[model samples]
Target: MSAPDVFAPARLGPVTLRNRTVKAATFEGRTPEGLVTDGLIDYHLAVARGGIGLTTVAYLSVAPEGRTHREVIVVGEHSLGGLTRLTDAIHETGAAVAAQVGHAGPVANGRSNGVKAIAASSMPSPLSMQMVKAATEADLTRVTKAYVAAARTLVRAGFDVLELHMAHSYLISSFLAPGLNRRKDGWAGSLENRARLGRQVARAVRDEVGDEVAVTAKVSLSDGFKGGVTTADGLAFAQLLEQDGTVDALQMSGGSSLMNPMYLFRGGAPVKEFAASMPLPVRLGMRTPVGRSFMKTYPFEEAYFRDKALQFRAGLSLPLMLLGGINRRDTMEQAMADGFDFVAMGRAVLREPDLVNRLQSERVESGVCIHCNRCMPTIYSGTRCPIIDLELAAHRDPLPQI
Candidate 1:
């Protein structure tokens, strides 16, 4: 079988990707005490050597308070040794590396970190159901500096790309959502106000990294919650980032922390009816029902957003990367045919580290990802893929319960 256009070379800002396939930022439980472990480095190297154009390191926290948990890799100036080694291993496999920088905000595990979780307002997360303290002006400033410091560290570590994680109910996404951010201050209320922090973070990163590194944003097209950030708002924010001249590319995703488990992991629901039977109230104003129904009929191998991703792309002039359930050559080709510049895969790489190489050499008929979402639940338990039998072959011991 011939490889599709997705395997073709493309430009992601200043860096040139060998193919459109990007290993989306998926957390591995290997980072211990904010330092990269040999297991993490080897995991990424496997994906890189497997033939991915780029591999993203997950949850590289800009600040200790922003950390989702203590196990996540810290990208501050103090934690460069492990990061540099990780990047070197990926580069050795001939794959470009991108770091996903984020702040967990109110979603940060307060019980795990023993620190007050902060957000745009004092709203509680539906998932964790914990109340977050409203961020003070000083807190916001400190977080912004943390992001800049992290980006500078990534550049120093020789990473080719930096992705600001502004989606999935993180600090930035929480601030952007009207339902989450009810503050009357300058950082809240209106769309422009909600986007202020993200814009500032992008600018600060650009200032720190300059033209040498590519800067991109992973933005939620819809929060999948009532009165939250909408596609219209996302389009506006993408324009804002573009106008600021700091963002090099845009990756579009949907759903907030409260809604759509399938948002990040496409095809996780065993039966299509299960996805259809999900409470529509949870999806509310977003066009999730329509998109979900379409996914049911099509069942593409790539990310779930491949079909509707162009809707967000059409609204922006910059390069757009589609993420979700992408896992096959045909689906990837379709994504390119529809104008997506990149296809981002998460669980596919988790299940089969050499998926890219196998696909390129026609050694595998299809990706090994079963889409069970067992990997997602493991994030809380210790963030490695539980279903990846071979990857866990060495660790036959029982995992500690979360």
Candidate 2:
């Protein structure tokens, strides 16, 4: 059989995407006040107007304590109006929108959020340099309810999809990682128990939305280090998700936000740039031996995660979205030929939001992104490509709202 066309319409749950290309969720750094701003809307508008099938707004935490920093949006009634406006604007460009909901867990900055980080078990939080407390049963119940609340709010905001962040060593993924989760209670030990929180959240969100929109998950294929979830354990957890019959698709990703993040976006590490972006105290820490260990580097390759994701593709029948270092049309076509349902691009799209349209019209060999990964540090102020002139970005034509 011929490979499925990369530009053709595709169904994700009940939503029909204009094309199979998705602008995967990358923290925009536009919401500095924990609420939507013109910058945030314009960021997604750039991708929508450029012709992405779906553009995901990233890192909407379920609770304030769950936020990675003070500036992260806490999905709730307070932010409803701004979120609604953001989604409506994207729909005007004829592209679907999704919300990436997650709890930062050990990844949360306690100093910034003015709350202690909560994890499956107490551990030293490197972000805040404080001891993270173990989540009690009451805390678990509150978090579950928060997930449901976030789902309802996203649906109300006109989002066509809800992607539960179950990867990157956040609350859910942290619980699933044996090295991070040392709890002896029902939420730990066996793989089934460790996976319970993620399954419950997915089922709850699905029950709340009930086909109103697509329900998907971004799950880790591995934690990218020893003592983390292995490929075997990751696959087993994915099977549990499939058996639950709740999630419509799974976007495969890896690495721990708390530890080895470069495992997910392999390229130049940009260690010096990352240090320079931080405050003086933290800057000094980043230059230390231990700090350098946290910023591990890896070589870049197109479809870097394809070999590992293929294992899930072969083992499970659920729809899968292939991510990590996809910068060319042939790579996307290859994913479709391999039976994947969608292809998600992060840095490549950030480098050129209009690359999808260019790929269709210009027939370019590949995107202009060099995978320098310098853009990684810019997430602190505003997620942007330095190659693009700041003055030009400030003066670009704005899209008309319908």
Top candidate by lDDT: 2
Could you give candidate 1's per-residue lDDT for residues 101-144 as a string of tens digits?
98988657654555767888886443233556899999989999
Top candidate, metric TM-score: 2
In each prediction, how many residue pairs overlap at the backbone (N, C-alpha, C within less than 3 A)?
A: 10, 0
Pairs clashing within candidate 1:
29-383, 50-357, 301-327, 302-325, 302-326, 302-327, 303-324, 303-325, 303-326, 304-325
> Cα RMSD for candidate 1?
6.9
Instruction: Give the poorly placed runs of model 2, Cα more than 4 Å off.
Output: 284-290, 390-402
Count: clashes, candidate 2:
0
Whole-model lDDT values for every prediction: 0.77, 0.90
True-vs-predicted CA distance for residue 96, candidate 1, Å: 0.9
TM-score of each: 0.85, 0.95
Among all windows of ten consecutive residues in candidate 1, which has the lowest summed lDDT?
277-286
